[model samples]
Target: MTWKVLLPVGEATEVMDTLYPIFRLPEDGFEVVVAGPEPRLYHGVMHEIPPNENIPWDITREQPAYHVRATEAFRDIRPEEYAGLFLSGGRAPEYLRYDQDLLDITRHFFEAGKPVASVCHGVEIAAAAGCIQGRTMTTVAKCALDVTQFGGIYVDQPVVTDGNLVSARTWHDNTPFLKEFVRLLKASVAPK
Candidate 1:
């Protein structure tokens, strides 16, 4: 049977962070299902440091918008229906971490010991949901404290996998992170 994956959607979701898995997961035969606070189009953002000093340092990166729609809502999702879950990066997690429904969905994967992957600011959701305890992960350096504060070992690596959880610091690390995640998903789907 083909596996299903839950991808949480939100405003300002980092474009590369969200899109890489959206396309890659399906290549491995897992259906990527987007979910959000509501089942509708969510805006995506691009992040990159400016090479020109003409731009303000505080606004080092340029932000461009893209639209992504969610197929379902967290409150209505059945976590067991999916074989894996992927949490994406962006400023979205700063607010999404507070969402009770999202938190519940985040918890289900960890509690079930299912395949889970998170990148960049996505660590905030896992930390907020109390799923990072005793696990090791890597996120954008700024969020290193968030993971440690939540009792997770914060490593500064391109990819880190502990048990069924896999993480990457940023889009630059997506290649390795996605490779490991696909391996885990395939291993799970392999005949036991």
Candidate 2:
């Protein structure tokens, strides 16, 4: 059987964080479905602290990059149809946290014990969904509160796996992040 996964995105979704899974998941035969606040094209952005010889910026610099289409709107999603949930990080989650539909979909993955992965600001969505409580995970240092505030334990590391959920600090950790996510997806399925 084909394994389907859901990726939630919004405007300004981090290109690296969002695109990595879009391509990587298919290589392992997991069909990736992108969902957003609406079924439309959303812009992606590059986020990084540009190298500076003098004073360094405290936050990442954002510049527009590519576009990713959301074929499905969050309100239309059927969480049980997916085998996994991947939340890509970006400034999007700052507002997406208020999306009731997205929050509900997020909760389903955790409630069902389906494999879930999150990176950077992606944790905000999960935290808002009330699914992070008591779980150990990692995310960009700035987002550490998203975990602790939601009664989850936060760790500073490349990746953290607690039960069916896997998380990473940022896209830079995608190597180990996606590797572990793929393993979890494959293992969740029974042999034919």
TM-score for model 2? 0.97
Segments of candidate 1 deviating more than 4 angstroms: 55-62
Q: Compared with the true structure, what per-residue lDDT tens digits does model 1 show for residues 26-132? A: 99899999999999988898887666677556532748778888989889999989888899998888899999999998899999888999999999999999999
Instruction: Pick the TM-score winner.
Output: 2
Give one digit per residue, the lDDT tens place, for model 2 in 13-33. 999999999999999999999
lDDT values of the candidates? 0.90, 0.94
Tell me the alpha-carbon RMSD of every candidate: 1.5, 1.1
Alpha-carbon error at 84 in model 1, in Å? 0.6
lDDT of 1: 0.90
Question: Cα miss at 73, model 1 (Å)?
Answer: 1.0
Candidate 2 clashes between residue pairs 3 or more apart in a chain or in different chains: none
